[model samples]
Target: MTSPPRRLPGEGTAHTVEQSAGELARLAMARMDETLGWYRELSAAQRSQVGLVAQAGISQFVEWLRQRERHAPSAISIFANAPQELTRAVSLRHTLDLVRTVVDVVEARATSLAGPGDEQLVLESVLRFSREIAFAAAEVYAGAAEARGAWDARLEALVVDAVLRGEADDSMQSRAAALGWDDVAGVTFVVGRAPLAASSPDAPAATVDSLRRAARHLGVEALAIVQRDRLIAIVGGTRDPLPVVEHVADRFGPGPVVVGPTVPHLFAAGRSARAALSGLTAAVAWPGAPRVVESDELLPERALAGDLPARRRLLDRAHRPLTESAQSSQSPLLETATAYFEHGGSLEASARALFVHPNTVRYRLARITDVTGYDLTRPRDAWAVRVAVTLGRLGGTGATPGPAVGLSDAGQPAPVGRRGLEESSNL
Candidate 1:
């Protein structure tokens, strides 16, 4: 067999450097101090930790050169010898700065330290090592970021759960603050069907991410959770939540999406959550409801479903306002509205029943609409009015069926006519 090939000068120098690894490490550390401002910015403990890392890196480089024929050592593992806490104390950029400084020192000393004709080879190896170190730093930071993101998601889910269960307290607020919810100005809960899991195992998470992305685009804050087949989101930072809801409506699955009224803050978001969840539960009652419907608009359906809060809401928003006006017989707007509805919305019939001209009935209906904010002409508004009237009657308010009133052109009560009495009886 041929005599073993004589070791190259570059190979011999690599062995020499490995024998003096401790000296090379010290030189790298000194250069790090001279070159990097951020290094000096580190605390004493952090700086000592970085020094250990620098030393390990130089020693690892020498070991890799000695074993070059076996296999190149992994540059990433050089950081393994340092305490994991170093990753936190030194940011990726700062870590990269350290790596650059170390590499620069190695490159500058290569000609003097390496055997004849080995300087170029040593410099090339330092370049390769620096590249790998940068990649390793990036991996470390990415992992940390992913871990933080997952923890934040769990905390967000908890906060949403607390709000839904109406158990929001100081601890929940603290958790919310940790998730950066301090700037939220107003809060509203939105509920809709979650995306189907058949499409993807993480479809719920994806849907929530989509909602968050949409909320961000709208310059609002959102915290969402996937509970069974429903996805609920607490949206905040906007007084006018309708536009925000509409902006994010497409993120929810196909169904009626209900938005609760905007509460003043997140702690009061439980009110919005209660209303939104109730609306979502009762949404089936209105099959043709708009894609984005306000929780208050679902009161009639919610009340019909035995929701006491909905019943009270109907009384407050529809029944009480109308009935309060009926306390005075001079304001015949309520009676005219009752006759208008009872007479099948016929202007002529209501006019005849009220003993007034059609124009007078029209004027009274206008006044009623102005007071109640419910236009009698619209079918949905008509349904709300009818439901309110029924609820008022059931509540023993005597606010329904509109007491008969005869009105003259001067807008004061006039004596009832026999014809009007006959027409009223027919109604």
Candidate 2:
């Protein structure tokens, strides 16, 4: 068994300090106000609370001195009598200032306050008690800090859940507001695999911290959540999200990271979230997809996977523009594109099929690219155009049929180039 702590030789001075405790408490308060600016800044209510805490410290010191077998009072328990709000108003540093003032006052008066020849004992005891008070102050503040961190984490999780669920109601807005998301603009959603922790169960928090640190380094605001194996982030205050997402890409686990289109604010972020989630879900279809795939870039795969929004997007972004161009400009942009793809992207083969020169076919392909944003020469753009053409044919009404130049099985290609020249001359 451990031996009992040896008693300091100041038990005789215990009664001396008890008699002067009231005087010492008054002096400590006066010195704290005079020497510490923060102490004087405390509100009237907070000042009263500080006075009570100082008096308690001195009384507790005397009580410890009077006990034959001394036990230091629990430092954590010192703030128990004061209101919890007092800890918020008076910071730990300022509490140390009060403790220093109390120690200084007692030490300065030790010679007169102690019994004859016991001044040294009184001064030593004051030093020892001040050390305990400092330790106690640290414990109190640490506990408060821990509680605050936990509360903030829970609030963050709630806000993330609300965003994911597309619940942008007033209650959801209020929660986001509580988390200081009000100032953030141009919100975007990013979806990727969550990083695996090296060891600890707190890996989720560690992963989140890594994301936050990366975002801060890049001067962006981010809120993250780990849902099972997936990590989702709502990034804000950036119109250009690709660079921001690229900078923090390594924070995710090894997988495709997809960024959604940016919205104006957090409430509209649900649109971004939906698009990101759709891309993430269909990312596997394109195994060689980019590290940071824009949500719209995955439209073909998402549409093939039966995503209605993706299907609608393909039609709006590709088919509608080409059809409008063909009607207004009298160019067979769509027919030439269909023939070019069907003939395995051979310009000469498409030209013969359309009864136009190879140069004419090349010029029409360029116009197709201009209208649909897909260059028929590239493989990925060709595939996207193929999907958009299929969607268009299936959805279009009164699609005119002209030449059997390998359009769709349902309808012939509208001959608007050299093929249109021959037919119009015969007419």
**Among these predicted structures, which one has the highest lDDT?**
2
User: Per-residue CA lDDT of candidate 1, range 331-371, in tens?
Assistant: 67667778888999999998899899999987877776787
Task: Give each model's whole-structure lDDT.
Answer: 0.75, 0.78
Q: How close is candidate 2 to the true structure, as a TM-score?
A: 0.77
Candidate 2 lDDT tens digits, 359-408:
99989888888777888899999999898888789666744323122222
Model 1 misplacement above 4 A:
1-59, 69-115, 198-200, 328-330, 397-427
RMSD of 2: 12.9
TM-score of each: 0.77, 0.77
Per candidate, the number of residue pairs that clash is: 0, 0
Cα-lDDT of candidate 2: 0.78
Model 2 Cα displacement at 394 (Å)? 1.5
